[model samples]
Target: MPIYIYWGEDDYAIERAVVTLRDRILDPLWTSFNYTSFPPEQSDAAIAALNQVMTPAFGAGGRLVWLMNTTLCQNCPENVLAELGRTLQVIPENSFLLLTSRNKPDERLKSTKLFKQLATEFREFPLIPPWKTELLVQAVNQAAQTVGVRLTPQSAAVLAEAVGNDTRLLYNEIEKLRLYAIEQNRPIEVDTITRLVRNTNQNSLQLAAAIRVGDTGKALTILADLINAAEPELRIVATLVGQFRTWLWVKLMVESGERNPGAIAQAAEVANPKRIYFLQQEVQSISLRQLISCLPLLLELEVSLKQGRAELSILQTKVIELCQVCRRN
Candidate 1:
């Protein structure tokens, strides 16, 4: 429990866990001195936090050094790794080092190997697949409870389906539901969720699904809706990129004779391994090279958008080009 490594895309869960650590370790009144949060945005942030972890706590109570989004999981410089290894030896019992990241620790990286030795202290909250209604429902139900609001399983299911599996967005939606429930002085109902939740309106998955099937017309329509909804172009691009990457992984795994759906899904970072069977059947018809062609086009699309050159016309063209590969029967 002294060295906790929490890695996941679920910022909501990660933040909650971090807060729990803070409450359990740091004195409430001396929080300013005992608790420290180091996000990845600052240069040399992880190195600085690692140094602090070895320093003994000042005054009374324990010290918490939260190293959020630690890049050490990547190919960290040998000097930093050496210093971290040394610091770990002297980290006082009253001091804690909490490492977190959005992506899982890449198994290929040597840095991950060091962390692997401490596997018992590591916690991973992977991406829950959008198709896993039960998991989503459980997430929603637990979230509602956290906010002191009661939510029906049906209502929870509705929210999960509409919003997909992004816990950050789910937390925001939960706040809104709680506010609405407070105003009404009642538990959340499916009708209440249907009226207040705008998840279907905000989600861009339909666009990606349409593009996957090469339904250009539907894709274009969905894109228009997204644009009108003021969704950032980069967000839409990210969603499509993730979908294409998943398809490519599934295709490659099947070609490599990986029959275990759980293994493939885990490698692909899909939370719901049961859904991998469907992903397998879907990608079986899609050629590997055909899927590979979409990556460069998508890269170009992202670059053009970032350069302010990819307009609706350009987006339409590139989207169609990317989807064309899936059309191969």
Candidate 2:
């Protein structure tokens, strides 16, 4: 596809895909003339990217013009979309326009709609949520290849288990694993992942699990470790919200007489249906009233964090309070 569009929250994967395309299309020796990148934050650069794409390659190989890290997903002015739509028509087969953003493309935007018309050339790489182990494993494997790290199936499984659904921090762990493996002159293994990769993700999960079970002491300790690791309180709050939101959905579905975990997971947007079984068990101990109560607490924590009103200690205190409420009598 001459016109390529890639958008997703997986920033590292998005970048790697762009790099692969660049290597495949442009000549390195003539990079200055063959490739150009623009940030579409302003009108001029966005327009410039469009205008440049129609220009022919300098000497050899195809030319590439890129609109990188664009906010068009958030808001695309009418003029910009109109201009982009016009530019797409004139762009030569020899030149490629790469439109990418970390934000999911706004389906409602005119520009996004226009871009969608050329769907044959488009690629969307949305973030794979943590529960989708298979997708995470696939992405992790691809990343390992790019970063020159070797991962055995067992090692990959370990990494996938460590951060199955969320990949925001997976790249960081992969990079660290690569460095440590090179230093040790060995391949990445389950033990290597255990010893080298930070267990902050696991701890966060433990904190959420503890909160679900209403183990205040365990939850508070995990919170302390996460803070000591310099993990942001906002991030911690987001994680809790996500976990509880899933539990709440599962709980609601069960109360409504939904017996199928797959159906419940589909409704909840949980990528893995099999996980719904465990979630059902977790929420079984807590009443619907209790499950419903968790939402307001998390929302309050989020608002306080966003407003910069609460520090770590205050947030931890709130989490402890939440644990007490979640505990079954």
Instruction: Name the best candidate (by TM-score).
Output: 2
TM-scores of all predicted structures: 0.68, 0.80
For candidate 1, what's the RMSD? 6.0
TM-score of 2: 0.80
Instruction: Show model 1 residue runs off by greater than 4 Å.
Output: 39-47, 108-110, 131-134, 183-187, 200-202, 208-219, 228-314, 318-329
RMSD of each: 6.0, 3.7
* Candidate 1 clash figure, as a count: 0
Tens digits of lDDT, candidate 1, 231-262: 66777777778777888899999999998988
